[model samples]
Target: MFEPSRIKNFVFVQKIIKSELMYLQKISLANFKSYEYESYVFSERVNCVVGENGIGKTNLLDAIYFLALTKSSISNQDALSINHEAEYMMIEGSFEIGESGENITPITNNQSLITISIQRGQKKAVLRDKKAYERISEHIGKFPVVMLSPNDTDVIRDGSEERRKFFDGVMAQLDSEYLENLLQYNRLLLQRNSLLKQFSERNYVDDLLLDIYSDPLVEVAVKIHQAREQFVTQFLPLFKKHYATLSDAREEVEMIYESEVGAENFTQIFRKNRPRDLAAQRTTMGIHKDDFAFEINGFTLRKFGSQGQQKSFVIALKLAQFEMLSQQKGFPPILLLDDIFDKLDDRRIQQLITMMVDGTFSQVFITDARPERTRQLLDNLGVEVKYFEIVK
Candidate 1:
C-alpha cells in the first residue's frame, strides 16, 4: 500500500539515493515564445506545476522536453509560438547529479551542478563540479526523465510514428549510440528513397541504381529492424506486467510487430515488390512500414477499445517505459503527468497515486486544469507534495 505522507517518511526511512534527483535547481526562460521571462526552482522530490489552460503549463514542460531531446514537443506549432520580437530563443537550466568516478564508495551526498541551454536551434550542455565538466553526456543520461502528457493518449489512437517515437526517444536517453545510428539510418533512408524515385524516371541505369542504392538501404533497414525487434521483445513483457498491475488483470494486452518489409526474408520481399516499388517510385517494404498492433484479448484497441480502456493501455505503456528505463540505466526516470487526471475516475487515480506516493519515481512534474481537485487527491495520500500556480 502506498501511503502519500509516507513519501517524506520513505525518504527518511531509506538511505539517501544520491543518483536520485536532488532538486530542479533553477530554470531561466527568455524570448522563448509565450514565456518571455519565466523562472522556477523545484523541490528535491515532487514538484507539481499547476495552472489554468493556455497559461504556459504545457510550455514549461515543453521547455524541459526541448532541453532533453533537442526538439520541441509540439512540432510544427513551434514557429508560430516563438515570440514576435525574438529572432532566436533560449531556455537555460542548472541542476545536480550524483557522482561517478574511480571512487568505489557509494554516492553519499555526491552531486554536481549541470548547466544546459538551447539557443538558435542548438543545444549547449555541460555538467560541472563547481568548475569543470565531469562528463557532458553524463548530464543528459544521469538525470533520466520521462514526460506523459494528455497528448500521449494519442499513442493508442494515432499512427505508428507516435508509438515508434515513444520507444526511440526513451531508448535515445539511455543509448547515445542508438541515437546516432537512428539518425544515420533516417538520413540514408531519405537519400535512398530519392534515388529510387529517380531510377523509375529512367534517369539512372539498373546496375548503377543497384550499386548505389539497394545494398546500403537493405543493410540499414536490417539493423533497424533487428534493434527494434530486440527492444520490443524485452519491452512487451514489462508492458504486460504493468498493464496487469494497473488494470488488475481485467484485460490481456498483446503487441505484434507488423512490418511490410524487413522480415527474416526481407530481401526476397523487396525483390518481389520492386516492380510495384518502381511504379510507386519508392521502396515501400521496410521497417518504415512497420506498426505495433496493440490488442486486448482478441480485439484491437485501435479499432475496438473504449476511450477509457485506451487511456489505461497508454498509461500502462508509459509505466512500463519508466520501469524499463530504470532497469536499463540503473535509475527510475522522472515522471511527468500533464492533465492526465481530467477524465480518470477516482479509483484509477488512486491506483496511479499508489504507484508514485512511495517514491517509485525519483521526481515527478504534473499539471491540471483544476488545481484544487488535484491538491485534494494528493492530500488523501498524506504526502507533502509541492505545487505552483502559473499566471499569464
Candidate 2:
C-alpha cells in the first residue's frame, strides 16, 4: 500500500534533485563580429551588455547564441561572422552545471568548456573540453538557450518560411530525433528536386526513379509531419497561458499549424503530386511547405493585430518556448534579450524582470543602448545584475 503523503514527498525530492541549472561563467571572443578580441565574465543570474549603436552589444549576445546553437543567430553566413580584418574567429565559453538552492553549488564542482571556431577555408569546429565534436549537431540541446529580439516580430509578419523556421528551431532543441528527421527530409527533398530538374531538362520522365526518390521522402515526411503536429498540440496551451499573463487576459490568440500531409495519405498524395511537381520542377507537397498561422480575436495577427498586440504575441511565443524547453530539458534555458527594452512596453518588461527575480529563469543576458535606462529599469527588481559597456 502506498501512502499519499509519503509519495508526494518523494516526488518533491526527486524534482529538486533534477532541477539543476546550467549557465555560462565566462566567455572569450577572438575576431568575431564587431569585436577584434574581447572576453566577458557573466553573472549567473543576469548580465547586461550596453553600448552605443554599432558598438557590438548585439554581437556579444549572438556569440553566446552561437555557442549554444552552433550557428550564427543573426546571419546564415558563417564567414560573415568573422571580423573583416581577421582570417578566423574563435568563441569559447565556460559553463557550470549544478544543483540550485539557497547557495547554488556545482554537482561536481567542475566547469565544462565549449569552444567554436571558423576559418576562411576550413570546416567550422566545435570542441568540448578540447575534444573536437565529430558532428556539430551533437552539441545542440546540451545547453539550451532562447533568444528574444526585435526581429521576433518577423515570425508574425514574414512569410510562412520564417514561421516554419521558428517552430522547427524550437522542435529541434526539444527533440534530437526531429532534428535528424528534418535534416534527412531536407536532403531527400533536394535530391528529389534535382531529379525533377533533370527530368524536365531531358524531356523524359522515369516513373521507377521517381518512385525510388518518392518512397524515402514520404517516409521522412511522415515522421517530420507527425513530430510537428505533436509539438504544436503541446505548444498551444503554453502559448495561450503566457499570452493571457502578458495581456492580462484581455485578448484571445491562437496558433494554427497547416500542413499538406495532415489527414491525408501522404504516400498517395506524393504519387498524385508527381505530375505537378515535375511540371514545377520541385517537390511542392511536404513538410517543407508547412506553415504556422498566428491569430488574435479569430483573425490573422498580421492583418488585424496592433503593434502592441503583435509584440505581446511574439513575446508570448518566446516565453512559451522557454517554458516548454525548461519542462522538456529538466532545467531552464539561458534567456537572451537583444534590445528588448526598446521593443516591449514597460509592463511587459516588468513581467520579464519579475520572472528573473522570482527564479523562474536561471541565467539571462540583455542588451541595451541606454545604460542608465537599463539600470533604472532593473534597479527596482531587487536582483543582482552585471553590466558590460562596449566602446568603439
Candidate 3:
C-alpha cells in the first residue's frame, strides 16, 4: 500500500533512472589525418578541441566522426584521411550506452568499443566489441552522429546531388530499410548504366536484357522514392520549426521534393526513358534523379537568399536533422561542430549554447582555431565542458 504522493515520487525517480544515456567516452587515433598518434578521454557532455590553424583540430573531430560513421566526413578518399607519411590509419572510440541514475551505479555492460582501420591499397575494416562486422553499413546508425561544418553550405550552393545526399544521409540513419533499398537501387542503376554504355558502343539494343535490368531497378526505385517522400513529409515540419526559431519567423522557407517519376507508373517511366538513357549512356531518371528544391518566400535560396540567411537555413536544416534522429533513435545523436562558430553569427551561437545547456544535446564535440575565443564563448555556460588544446 503506497500513498499517491509517494507513488508519484517513485515513478518520477524511476523515469529519471531509466533515461537512456549514450556518449563517446574515449577516442584513440593512429596515423589518422594530421595525427601520427594521439589518444583522448572525453567528457560525457561537452568537449571543445582548440588549436591554431593547421594544428589538426578538424582532424581530431574527423577521427571521432570516422569512428561513428566508419568513414571520413570531409574526404571522399579514405587514403586522404591517413597521415601523409603513414601507410595505414586507425581510429577507435569507446562509447557508454545505458541508463544512469543519481545514486545507483549503472551496469557496466553498456560500453561499446568500435574500431576502424584502413591500410594502403586495402579496404577499410570495422569492428565492434572485438567482433568484425560483415558489412560496414551495419554500424552506421548504431552510434548516430550529426555534424555541422563549413562544408554544409554545399547543401545550398551545390546542385541537386548534394541535396539528395543530405536527405539520403538523414534517412539512412533513421531507417535501415531505406538504406538497403537505396544501396540496391544504386547498384542496379550502375549495372543498367553499364549495360546502356555497352549497347551504345556496340550500336545495338537488347530489349530482353534491358527489361531484365530495368525490372529490379524499377522495383527498388519505387521503394527508395516512396521512402524519400515519406521522409520529407516528416522532415519538412521539423525543418520549418527550427527555421522559425532560428530566424524569429521573419522568413518563410520551403522545400519541394522534385522527382521525375512522380505519380507516374515506374515501369512506364523506365520504358519511356530507356531510349533517352541509351542516348545518354547513363541513368536519366529514378530516385537518383530526385532533388529537394529549397526556396525562401517562393524563390530559390541559392540564387536569392542572403549569406546570413543561407547560413541560418543550413543551421536550421542540421538542427532539424538532430531533432529527427533523436526522436527516431530514442536518444540525441552526438553533435560535431567543426569551425562552425566562425561561420555563424553570435545569435546563432547563443542559440546552440542554450540548446546545449538545456540538454537538447547529450554529447558534443566542437573544434575551433581560436583557443581564447572558444574558451570565452563557453566559459560562462556553467556546464561541464572539457577543453583539449592541440599543439604542433
Candidate 4:
C-alpha cells in the first residue's frame, strides 16, 4: 500500500490497499512487563523482534502495541503489565506521521510523542507530546494497530464472548460513536447485573427501581446491537474476500452475526426473563449474548474446519481488519505479528512475507522465537528492515 508494487496473480490480492503515511519512529519502556527499561529506534517499513521462547519478544511487541492503543494486547488489567519488581509502568513512543518515505530522520513537526503510564492505586495516564488527554478514548484511532497471534483462532473456537470481544475491538478502533455506545452498554450492563444480584440477595423485587437500570441498559443494548449488525454487514464481504484469496478456494465462506436483540420481541422477552436473570444473578438476554459465527460451505468452521483452515480464516479476518482500518483512517495502522511464522504453515508464511516485502503493509512489527529462520526470510526483502535481537 505504501508503494506502487505490481500486483500479479498472487495468493491474496482482491483489493488495492491505499497509501500509508504513518509509522512509529521510536519507543521506550519502563517497568512494563519483562523490560525494566529499554528503548529502540525503528525503521519506517518493517521491524522484526527475534529471541528465544519466553525471552520477552512478545512483551516488546505488546509495549509498542500499548503505545498505539493505550492497552495491552494480551492482558486486560494494566496492573498486570507492571513489572513484578516495580510498582508502576510506563511506555512511550515517537511516531513519524503525515508523510511517507524512506527518510531516516523525521521532521520535528511531524513527530508525535505518545506516552502511557500507570501507578498502582491510580488511574492510568495517556499523553500526546507531554499533554495528557482528558479522555483516553480520544486516542483510539490516532494510532491504529492490528495484532495477529496464533491464539487468535480462539476467537472462533472459543465461547461467544471471545467472538464478541474480537469484533467489538475491531469496531471500536474505527468508530468513535460505536466505541462510546459499547462503553455505555457495558457500564449499563454491569450496573444492571449488580442490581440483579442485589435483588436476589435481598429476596425482594422492586420493579420500579429495577426499571431505573433496565431502561438505560436496554436502550444502550439496542444501540450496541445495531452497531454490531451494521459492522458485520460491512465487514463480512472484506473478510470473505481475504479468505477466498488466502485459501485460493472459494468454498462459500460467511460470517453470520447472531444476536438476541434482533428479535422483535426482544424487549418483551427481556422483561419476561427477569426471573431467570435474577436466578442466574446476571443479565441473561441482550447484545452480550451476540456471537459471530464463521462458516465454510455452510458448515460451522469451528467444528468442521481443519487447523490450517482455521488459521487461514483468522489470519484473513485480521487482514480484513487491517485493510478496513487503513481505508477508514486514511493511513495504514501498525501491524504486529506475534510468533506467527512458527505457527503458520509455509504457504501462508510466504504469502505474509511477500505482502510485507511488496508493500501491502506499513510499519510492521513481527515477533519470532527462531532468529535463524526469521533472518533467513527477512534478510532478502528489499525494504527498510530492522531487527531488534533480544537476549535474555
Candidate 5:
C-alpha cells in the first residue's frame, strides 16, 4: 500500500545524544505467546529480528511491549498471551536509563528491572525493581514506547471507536493528568449507565442520585473534550509535517475533531437526553460519542484515498506520535517496527534508515523476514545493526 516513486529525503544535521536515552538491554519470556522460554540480549542502537512468518518475531516484540505497558499490544486479554499448553505467562526486561552508547555492554549502571506475571483467573502482577506498583497504569509513562505495524491501518479504516482508542492511548502516555481524568470518566460512565438500567427495570428513579452522577459526568466529559481539542491542535503540525514528507508533499490532509460537547446547551442536552437515555438504557451523548474525521483535500480519506495514500497516512501518524513523545519525555521512546520493510520499496526504506542515523530514535527494533534485504539496505550505511535470526 505504501506505493511511492521516492520517499521524501529529510535534511537532519543533528547528532546522536545518548545520555538521555532509555533502552532495553535484556529480556526474558516464559509461557508467553509462541515463546515457551527464551532470553535475548539486545544492542543499544538497532536490533534486527529476522524469522520466517509465524515463527514468533512479532510475539517477541509484544513481550517487550508487555514489559513496558503491562498489557498486550495485540489484544486486551492477558490469557491470550499464555501459550496454548501453559496456564501462566511471565515477561521480564532489564533496562538502562540515561546511559551513553560508549558504556560497556550490559552496563549494570543505572539499571532497572520490570517484571510482569499472569496466571489463570488471577490478576497480573507487576514489579519495578522488585517493588510492586499500586496500579498498573502508573507504569505507563515511566518508560514510554511507540509501535508500528500493518494493523495500524485499522485506525483509518475502522469506525470511530478505533480512532478514539489510538488517540486516547497517545494522550494517556504523554499526559498523566489526562490519563487520570480519562480513567475517572470511564468509571463514572459505567456506573451511570447501570443506574439508568436499574431505574428502567424497577420503574423507580431517584432524581438526587441521578443528579449526582450527571453533574460529575458532565464536568469530566467537558474536560476530556477540551483536552482532546488541545491535543489535536498540538498534534496537527507534527502529523501534517510527517504526512507531507511521507507523501512527497502530495494531497492535502486534515483531521477535524467532532464533538457534541461544543454545543452551547451541552448541560441542557444531558437534561434533555435523559428520557431518551432511560429508553435506550445508556448514556448516549458525551465525549465518548466524539469522532475524528480524517480528510484528504476536504474529502474523507477512508472513502476516497487510494491504498497507497492510506498506508502513508497511517505510518505518518505513528511517526508524529514518536516525535511528540520524544519531545515531551526529553528522551526518545523505544521504537518497534514489525516487519515493516516488506511493505516499503528500497527507496522508501532509505528514508527510515536515514532517520536512524540522524538521531530520530534512540533505540529501534525492526523485524524482517528477509535478512539479506535488511543487510543490503544497511551494508554501506555505517549503522550498527545487531541481527537475531529465529528458526522454527
Candidate 6:
C-alpha cells in the first residue's frame, strides 16, 4: 500500500504538472454567484468538485464558461449574479496549453489572467488581463474549453436555438477571427433589422446604409458561414466515431446544416432576400438562421430518439467536439460533466468513465449528487484522481 505522505506528494506534483498537460490551470471567481471570493487551483489532469445542490457546483462551471467566451451557458439569466449587494462580477483563470510547436508558457510563475466585469445595470461588457491594453480575441486559442451538463440534453429535447448555440460556442472558441467577424455581422444585422422596421413604415433609407451595412454584412456573413462549415465538416467524422464508441454500434449519425436563404452565393442571396426582409421587418437569413440537424439512420433524432439514444448522442457530440478541438487547435478543451451519472446507467457510466480516463480528456471536472456513486466509480480507475467535497 502507498504511504499517506507519498500520496500527498503525488497529489501536489499533479496539481502543478505544467508539462504534458493541456487544460485548465486555475479558476478564480469574485462576487460571482454563490462564490463571494473563491479560487480553485486545478490538477492539470483530472479534478473533481463535489457539492450539494445550490452550493454553486454548476455555478463554478458557469464561471469557466464565462471566462472562455464572456458569455453564459444559458442565455436567459441575470448578468449581475455576482452577489446581492455587489456592483460587478468577475472571473479569472489560466490555461496550460501548447500551440504551433510552442508551449504557451506552461503555467509557470504567475498565471495569465482573464478578467471579466459587468457593472450594475450595464448592457456593455469589459475584459482585461495582465496588461492594460489587450484585445479580447487575443485570449482565444490560449485556453480552450468545452462543457457538458444536464442542460446539454436540452439540445435534443428543446427547439433548435439551444443546438445552434452549442455549435456557435464551440466554433467561436476555436476561431477568434470567426468570432470577431460574427460580432460585426450581428451588429450590422441588428441595425439592418431596425432599418427594415423603419422601411416598412415608409421611412427614408440613408444611402450609406447600403454601403456601410451591405458590404460588410456580406463579407462577414461569408466568413461566418465558411468557418461554421469547416467546423462542421471537421467535426462530423469524429462525432460519428465517438457515437459509435459510446453506443458500441455503427448506427449511422448525420449532421446537416439548415440555412434559410444564404445557402449559396451568400451575397446575392442576402440581396435577393432584402425586399422580403424589409416587408417582414426582420433579417431572416445567414449564419444566425442556420441550424444543425442530428439525424440517425436517415431520420431526425430530435423527434424520434429514445431517451437513451439522446443522452448517448449528446455525450458523443461533446466528445467529438473535444477531439476536434484537440486536433485542430493542438489541445483538447476542458471537459466538465455535471451530475451526468444520474442520467446514465452503471454500464453507460462505466463506458463514459473509461473513455474519460483513457486519454479521452486532458482535464475533467465532474460533479455528482451522490458521493458514494462517484467514489465507487472512481475507485475502479488506476490513474491519479482528486476529489473535493463542498459543504454549505
Candidates in order, TM-scores: namely 0.84, 0.94, 0.93, 0.93, 0.93, 0.85
Please, what are the lDDT tens digits per residue for candidate 5 over residues 1-392? 23233323222212224446678999999999999999999987789999799999999999988888888999899999999999999999998876445331323357889999999899999999999998878988788899988788899999999999999999988988888889999999999999999999999888889888899999999999999999999998989988888777888999899999988889998888998898998999998889999999989999999888888888788888888887787667889999888786565577778777666766889998998988887666556789999887
Tens digits of per-residue lDDT for model 6, 195-254? 878877876556466557777877787787777777888888878876776666757778
Candidate 1 positional error at 93, Å: 1.5
lDDT of 4 at 231: 80
Output the better candidate (2/3) by TM-score: 2
Model 4 per-residue lDDT tens digits across residues 38-154 = 999988888989888899999998898888888898999989999988999999989866634344223333778998999998999999989999889889888889999879999
Residue pair clashes in candidate 4 = 1-359
Candidate 3 lDDT over 1-392, as tens digits, reads 22243123123223332466678989998999888888999988789999898989988888888898887888779999988899998998898878765432345438999989999999999999889998788888898899999989899999989988888888888988888888888888889999999999999999999888899988888878888888889989989978887787899999999986666676786788878999999979887888899999999999999998899999989988887877777667889999988998888888788766555677889999887898888888767889999998
Query: What is the Cα-based lDDT of residue 136 in candidate 2?
Result: 80
Worst 10 residues of 1 by lDDT: 6-15
lDDT of prediction 2: 0.86
Q: In order, what lDDT does every prediction score?
A: 0.67, 0.86, 0.84, 0.83, 0.84, 0.70
Q: Per-residue CA lDDT of candidate 2, range 28-90, in tens? A: 999998888888898887899998988899999999999999998989999999999999999
Which of candidates 4 and 5 is the stronger one according to lDDT? Answer: 5
Give candidate 5 regions above 4 Å deviation: 1-19, 99-109
State candidate 1's TM-score.
0.84
| lDDT of the structure predicted as candidate 6 | 0.70
Which pairs of residues collide in candidate 1?
A: 4-381, 4-382, 4-383, 5-382, 5-383
Report the lDDT tens digits of candidate 1 across residue range 1-392: 53454233224212333343333556777777688878888755567788889998888877776655545777744454456777556666654545322221235444444434434455444335445344444444555677777777788888998877777777777776666667767777787677777777875537565546676777777777777778888888878876776676888889888765545677877777777777777767776677888998889898988877887888778777777776666555666777778867776677668756555655667888788888777766544577889987
Better of 5 and 6 by lDDT: 5
Index of the highest-TM-score prediction: 2
Candidate 3 residue-wise lDDT at 35: 88
